[model samples]
Target: MAKRIAASLVHAIETLFVIAAVALAVALLLPRLFGYTPYAVLSGSMEPELPVGSMVYVHETDPTALQPGDVVTFYRSDGAVVTHQVYEVDAEARTIGTQGIANKDADGSLVHDAQATPFSGVIGIAAFCIPYLGYAEAFCTTPSGLLAIIAVLALLAVASLLLGKSGSRRAGRRARGCGNDG
Candidate 1:
């Protein structure tokens, strides 16, 4: 009964580990393939709606479908990417406009021209946002972050190899003992 319990415990641990690994891998890879980019809110431009340090998952979409109050990421005329709320969208003229919530007046110029293509021009829209998750995501995407992950994986591989060797040795010893008794 004790042996059975031990085996069950080990199996449960292994299952949990596998589940965690799969979840982490999926979280990291899903965005890259689905035209989603996660961003950390760095400013209070869209205050009362999205705050700084918020982790937002943005998905690319058609510019024409954008509506007022929709938070979006767009390329400015100066070529800098900015995330703000859409204040107006002129479907007839093909212009997409935006403004910061805290700003006293609307932006001086339209952000996206009517001729602007769809998601071809958009980076993404927020699908999910968690406050303070940006730092962790940013750290994981850095050069040092990647190296740290590689190092940990290598360590796990070595540890698994050692554990497997020990387990096999124990199994062989048990078999030998049973044969001697027989």
Candidate 2:
């Protein structure tokens, strides 16, 4: 009974792991087919809405189409990519004012050069996000992580084969014992 229970538990765990891995792969790959780019959130600026380690999908859009309340990813003068909510748009000047949801002030002020982010700096508007999956994507891209995945798959295959062999052996032994008792 204990052996049966252990086998069931292991099978359940394997099933769950496979489902999770497939889901993650779909989430990361499906968007790319539709021209959406994934960017990992590295800060708490967009917290609650976009937590750290989340993967945000950005879709490139026309600058003139952007409006207040739209969330967008843009390049900063310093070369950093920032994702923020548009609080204002100046179509004439081709600039957009943005602010992080968690911040109390806009991204800039008159004292800070009095300039809104330029339309040319806009990369794309955020489409959707998957929390904590960015970390998985980042890790899976590394050499060590890929090797670890391969090792795990090999181990799982070996374990399944061993379990099958042991189960068949036990069945054969039970059949022999019953025949002897007859």
Candidate 3:
């Protein structure tokens, strides 16, 4: 019985380690291969399209090929970054305009010429989005998130230690109580 339990525990730990390694590899490789960045929508600015706390997978594109109604992520004149749907793209004029579906008006004036870069300048696009998953990702990036994970791991470790200790003690008692003449 002890041997069976030990084997099961070892298998479980090994399976968990393999899963963690695979997840880490995928997270690292995805951005390089796809040329897209993953961003979590943090506000209602683009609501009715991308809700708050949604995960967006973005792809870089060419500036000349940008069409109206395409959602874009860009840097503003003040160095602020925003993601909004393109209202207009004037290639000849080298200007782009964007509006939030939930906004009362277009975000002031059009994004000025020269300020707008090529689609290549866009770090990513909304490729794959999931609602609410961003919250977990965001939480995990913080110190508290790390602490929470550590706490859970510690709890599991303590439980495992106690179980192993009790099992060994029970086995020892059984061996001592058994009377055999050899």
List the candidate 2 regions with Cα displacement exceeding 4 Å: 33-35, 77-80, 87-97, 104-120, 142-148, 172-182
Candidate 1 stretches greater than 4 Å from native: 1-18, 25-44, 51-55, 77-80, 90-95, 102-121, 124-127, 130-136, 178-182
Give the higher-TM-score candidate: 1 or 3: 3
Per-residue lDDT over 1-182 for candidate 2, one digit per residue giving the tens place of the 0 to 100 score? 66667677777777886997898889888899999999889888888999999999999999899998899999988888999988889999999998887765455432221348899999999999989988888778789988988887787777777776877788887888843322
Q: Candidate 3 regions off by >4 Å?
A: 1-32, 78-80, 105-121, 176-182
Model 1, 123-180: lDDT tens per residue?
Answer: 6566777676666566667999879867766755665566667667767878888433
List lDDT for all candidates, in order. 0.67, 0.84, 0.67
The numbered model that scores best in lDDT is 2
As for TM-score, the candidate ahead, 1 or 2, is: 2
Model number with the top TM-score: 2
Task: Output the TM-score of candidate 1.
Answer: 0.57
Candidate 3 lands at a TM-score of: 0.67
TM-scores for candidates 1 onward, in order: 0.57, 0.69, 0.67
